[model samples]
Target: MTRTALRICPLCEATCGLTVTLDGDRITAARGDRDDVFSKGFVCPKGASFGELDADPDRLTRPLVRRDGVLTEATWDEAFAAVQAGLRPVVEAHGPDSPKFSASLEQGGTPIAVVLGNPNVHTVAGALYPPVLLAGLRSRSVFTASTVDQMPKHVSSGLLYGDPLAIPVPDLDRTDHLLIIGANPMDSNGSLCTAPDFPGRIRALRRRGGRLTVIDPRRTRTAKLADEHLAIRPGTDALLLFAMVHVLFEEGLVDLGERAAHVVQADEVERLAAGFTPETVAGPCDLPAASVRRLARELAAADSAAVYGRIGASTVEFGTLTSWLVDVLAVLTGNLDRPGGLMFPLSATGAAPRPAGPGRGFALGRWRSRVSRHPEAKSELPIAALAEEIDTPGEGRVRAVVAIAANPVLSVPDGDRLDAALASLDFMVSVDPYLNETSRHADVVLPPPPPSRGAHFDYAFNALAVRNQVRYTRPVLPLADGQPDECAIHARLILCLGGQDGADPALVDAMVIDTVLGKAVADPHSPVHGRQPDGLAAQLTGRDGAERRLDMMLRLGPYGEGFGADPEGLSLARLLDHPHGIDLGPLTPRIPALLRTPSGAVELCPAPIAAEAERLRGRLGAVPDGLLLVGRRHLRSNNSWLHNVPALMGGSNRCTVQVHPEDAARLGLTDGEPARLKGDGGEVEVPVEITDTVRPGVVSLPHGWGHDRPGTRLGVAAADPGVNVNQLNAGRLLDPLSGTAVLNGLPILLTPVR
Candidate 1:
């Protein structure tokens, strides 16, 4: 029998709707869901290859336990028993902090450490269960992929709005002018800002008379379609942005519009930016002074404009400063919180609108890592420091680890060190679907069932979506024999880690529901405030504990029914009724209510942010001279995750260094030949793709390669194992504020491999 099922693609941040053609339980084909309210009829290559990826022969179907120091297939019960035997001793005897990626490590009674990967936010269980698992384990500390990816943006948003989660995205559909720095939405499908069919949207913008400008070292696909491509010097984004700011202030273009009443410290920003004029920074940024002035002038003159930046800007020396300046430009031009500019996306699952007022402003550096002494931001230690934190023997050294859907061995910097550190752990477990680079070192590996056997939801991406919307899908296929859904894997894992190994998995969900409902009823502003927790629990509905938990959340969410408070509002039942998903409409201005600063106003010139300008000013006119390394994104790949899938491995997805013809000639490098690219940490000899896409002094390598480790079972990835670009990262260079690894815009040496 052939049947069609609707599912939101979990491959990337775009979160487009997908319609799968299933033959019985097997997914035969997948295509864009034309009726989807938000994504319309758009599906990227990643989405199209969903069936192949889900049915990859490399996917582990059973748990593997290390017996006699060798990983062998094991039953779920045996896996759980191994987990209990492994982690309990580490928690009781050695303590959990293991030297502090987590502040609770000092308090110690929980698990040693838990590291989450980028894929966690992509699924239902991933989005909901991680917090529960961490909280239940009293996890001394938690490390997420944020430290290596988007932490700077969170830090900057925290300092600006007094709430780290109060991030603003460019109004993509309506904007008149878009200045994109270090981002290739056409390739990435948008990160931080989630919008499906990003390339089509860009095309739409162009057709609608909107202008798009890109500022990056390499002319990415998005840049090729741009009105102007400013190939600025690597790691000098902050300097170029500051130059624009100086131009805005110099030309008297600092208009705050409605923001004038709520914005503070404009004069401070002006004084700070005074030193980074176009002329002063032109020599450093490798961009012309005239171009910088023109960019600033165009932004101010545009009917509506926005500045959107990504990893290229955030993974640099002044990541937080650069991120701050991106928004600073938006605000100065009176474009912030305005239509066709930047606006806060309010998800259906987000809290309802409230009057603007004082809030508990976000703070950083509550505690420091015991080993590196790196201050914490949003409770995350620098991922680049994970290897050192584990290998450095000291009080509270991490004796055990739990890695969920993460392959840090390839994702983070200095993989060789992390790989060695993982081997040294007293005990480690990985909740992964593949025996890949990182999980191969685990004492026990529990594989979650295929995506077809798991329900889908976009809890995290909803808030980041360009348009407000809600969507949900049940499992497209029943779980195979002995297979457990991801939610069950998580719930059972938490139980085992917490020393309640045989307890009912339902207990985990019940405890979480009670905890949330109990807190909600206590909050005076909550719709269910003063409502009995038991009563609320009884009102929830779902097929299992996970779904029931989802029901509870939706009932309590912003657009939720409030358990009858608003009968027509959102609920799990409501989402189930709309298989194609419900569109909640476009984004709107969220100013006073969105600001969480102590003053209940936008803090334009935060002191910590202002302090960075002086450091940036110190580098004025000091031009960089070397072949710098930067990472590129391909339309077919998303980090290291998709490489193992054969369908996604060809075309432009191959791992090779992109070098300009000018730089190649200088280095005596030939197209299709090999080059030894050396960096602070190490070096790798990779094939050179000579092109003029990149600037004269820079080189580009795609992130997430290096599948050549022994004992790994990735047949496709390991066959031609591409080199790991992150190997060149020393893991020491970090943004002073965010601790994000300098993944891009760093000086490196490139020589022809003779």
Candidate 2:
């Protein structure tokens, strides 16, 4: 028996570097790898608990199948056969499009071959998959967490810069002033901007004579660190941003000439913003007119300032508009793409690529749900409509489904409704690690091996990271007997369902070898490379001689005659040599140069957003005496994943209705008392935590809890299962443009549950 030190971290999108302490054959402890360049030894509480995930007693060690309405431990063959039998018919009848697969971005062992075998598999990170996978699916019905959160960034970037992937990263390191709206980067660990150790970054900014401001309804973790915190009303972010821009234009504070060359619809944006003066929109957003104007002036006067907005702004009724206006403010202030301002990622591929199409906004009825008429994005209806599509009888109905890693019944809007829909499916198969929540409804459950057994790539996170860097995670251990890898299980499913035999064994072997060797070549110290080698070039050419051209070019490129094997240059071997991680460098602004619009200018005030102005004003007029429900995020939870991890679930799991003390008194409720929240879908009784952290007339709840699944072995999470907030959320209300479920900003009635 021997012990070895390994560096790996796969907790969330942050991908912090980790040092695993091993004792013989067991992992004794985990700590942050201080020498890592990207994270710089930063590790979150979640990442520190990797040992628990590995040793959890409830972890599925073998496959399981439901027979006679009871789940029984079974062999891998039995499980695969059951899944194949159940899903084959669905593939035959509806084609691959009907059998949608949803998996988490971090799940291990998902077979790329199986995923690519069928065009129907839907992943949250579909944008990062290989070209073969993307080309095969070919349908607009695809739905993702992006539309519900960061679609605004994509849409705005595309409209203004001509490149959707050209999203701006807030250069916190160099920024003199940073304004964060509707976000808490401290807890989220920098959403859409992968900055590890965010707390330290904020502290450094303040230490360097920089200022930080947070505009949020709650005194979030990030707010506590801010130089100033503005408690604005929920769902009113767009208004606040508009007022900021309005003040900039009205007070002669804006440097229009600075941005004149890059701005596309500057005149249109100026005219539109004029209507949203601080005085007019301040009342709706519950902010003082003076504060709005002062903030706008501060932003405009700053030598370099960037306004960052995320989830809170993108998951509302006017998400697209709010997203659009945030960018408008950045551009109008002459900070759209500048150092110490909003900067773009310098990608290996130049820019984030999008699916080729009309390049217009979301369209309706291009493909509708068989039962609910819910608009389709690619070939799939929104997850919110999954239940109706399965239960309703009509042409193109979803009679069966093959879910991958995703627990939609718990994660989607209207959980109770989705559970019922899962029950109605003619056949259901789940490729997951546990028979919890959504998988309990499946006829067969195919579990993949643990994370340590899978090769890791941050394809999706790379596109969103604040800096440009790429790293691959190689499995630290070999697969155990009687269990198949994620890729193998997925491949089996695709082959069985498509009535096709498994891929050539040689091809499979070659792909696996390529992936492993490519990862090693990216490192600077692999045996194949006598010394340090450029991993990116290795990855590009690790295959049969095809990547040789790329390797030759990199060897001759200006960066160096040969891939510098040192930390100063870019190469995988160098990255591996130093386990701590390497800093790729700060992000730089790339707006007009990356803009793809016909006029080669940023579309500041696009027509689609302009046409909705009257409607926005009308909605702004109706915001009186209404309680808007919003969702909050915590560091401990990774949506539905961490509930089963004991260390993270030691405390409370019960959902809390965060109401302002004023609202609590007004509703005759007290802190820690039961409160009934009623909505169109249903009502749920949750405990109340009255705190001024929440603005008056607004209520908050952390999403992805309330696990009521029977036979689930998660003792910790089950001990204090929270109420499902989605049960009190309406599925009908959605962003018209993105068709993203409006998870926040629903008007609901609250009563004391007694």
Please name the candidate that would achieve the greatest TM-score relative to the true structure.
Answer: 1
Runs in model 2 lying further than 4 Å from the true structure = 1-4, 96-141, 256-259, 348-381, 504-579, 651-654
Model 1 C-alpha RMSD vs. true structure (Å) is: 2.0
Give the TM-score (vs. native) of candidate 2.
0.85
- How much does candidate 1 score in TM-score? 0.97
Clashes of each: 5, 32
Question: For residue 457, what is the lDDT in candidate 1?
Answer: 85
C-alpha RMSD of each candidate structure in angstroms = 2.0, 6.8
The residue pairs found clashing in candidate 1 are 98-396, 98-397, 98-398, 99-396, 102-141
lDDT for residue 50 in candidate 2, whole number 0-100: 81
Write the residue-wise lDDT of candidate 2 on 1-754 in tens digits.
Answer: 5554555566676777777777654666788877666787788888888877766667778877889988888987777677667756545444435433322111111111121111112121122222323233232234444544566566556555555666777877788899998888787787777778878889999999988999988889899989999998877888888888888878888775455666666777778877787888877888998999999999988888888888888887788788777777777777766777777776432222222223343323355544455554433345666666556565445566666666766666787887887787777776677767877887777777776665444545655667766554455566787566665565555456645434432233244335544554555433334433344434443322212332332233222124443325443344345444444566765544555676666667766578666567775554567687888888877777678787787444347889998888888998888999998778888889988888888899888788777867666677778877788775887766556678877888999976
- For each candidate, give its TM-score against the true structure: 0.97, 0.85
Tens-place lDDT digits, model 1, residues 1-754: 9999888899999999999999877789999999999888899889999999999999999999999999999999999999999987665554443444244455322337789999999988898888887765555456789988899999999999998888899999999999999999989999999999989989999999999999999889999999999999889999888888999889898899887888988899999988888988889887888999999999999999989999899988899999999999988999999899988998877776667898788787776676777778887778887887788876656668899999999999999999999999989999999999999999999999888889988888899888989898898889998887899899989888678889998998999899989998998878898989999999889999989988887888878899899999999988899998888889988898878898899999887788778887889968878878999898889888898888888898988999888878878989998999999889999999998899988899999999999999899999878899999988888888888888887889999988
